[model samples]
Target chain A: MKARVTVTLKNGVLDPQGKAIEGSLGSLGFEGVEGIRQGKVFDLELADRSEAQAKADIEAMCEQLLANTVIENYSIELL
Target chain B: MKARVTVTLKNGVLDPQGKAIEGSLGSLGFEGVEGIRQGKVFDLELADRSEAQAKADIEAMCEQLLANTVIENYSIELL
Candidate 1:
């Protein structure tokens, strides 16, 4: 099985890296770019686990390692 | 308008960060995880630009800033 997890900063959280990228975009002539927020994606290959078990495992993965729950939210898709 | 850009290590590209994460996952009792790859997502808000223009601008953004074309591939979606 394969799974994809997306971890994103919660709304209203400050993202300095995204801000820096936005600033660079403006300097590079990308006008009208008001803001940018950055996130992470993790693609994984797992053994033949059931979808339900995979979801539970991935949720635990996110809470334990993939995401900082203090500032980020995560969602997962199993394939 | 809003846009999302995803940058990922190209196939065959060595991803030390991902390997380290996978190692950590095993140590944390995530069994049967064979491999993992990590990517980045950038969400942006733009002024009233046409979707075509936004796409072009974001392509430039990825080429110049968001991705290292030497080892990464990026895709952008406008919303």
Candidate 2:
């Protein structure tokens, strides 16, 4: 099974990286961009496993290493 | 309008960050992890615009700022 994990900053967290990108876009003359938030994506190739098992494992991974949890949120998708 | 841009490293490009993540997972006792690749996601809010226009603008942003087109691929989703 293949899995994806998307990690995003929690609401109200300061995002300097996103701000930088927004500034750069504005400088480059790409107008109409009101706001931007940046996040992380992890694409995984896992050994063949049951869907349930894969999800469970990925959840654990997110909880343990993939996300800070205190300031970040993560979503998992299985394919 | 809202848009999402996902930028991923092109195939055959080395990802030291992903390698480090894989090593960390193994050390943390996450088994069945065959491989890992890391990418980026940008969540963008745009001034009200047609879908086609939003996509076009975002594509230009990607080509010029969001992505290093020589070694990365980007996809845009409008919401």
lDDT (tens digit, per residue) of candidate 1 on B16-67: 9999999999999999998999999998898987778878888988888899
TM-score of candidate 1 chain B vs. the reference: 0.93
| Model 1, runs deviating above 4 Å | none
Quality of model 1 by C-alpha lDDT: 0.92
Q: Please, what are the lDDT tens digits per residue for candidate 2 over residues B1-79?
A: 8888999999999999999999999999988799999999999999998888888899999999999999999999987
Interface RMSD after interface superposition, model 2:
0.5
Q: Whole-model Cα lDDT per candidate?
A: 0.92, 0.94
Give the TM-score of chain A in candidate 2: 0.96
Give the CAPRI class of candidate 2. Answer: high
TM-score, cand. 1: 0.95
lDDT per residue (tens digit) for residues A1-79 in model 2:
7888999999999999999999999999888888999999999999998999999999999999999999999999997
| lDDT for residue A75 in candidate 1, whole number 0-100 | 88
Clashing residue pairs for model 1: none
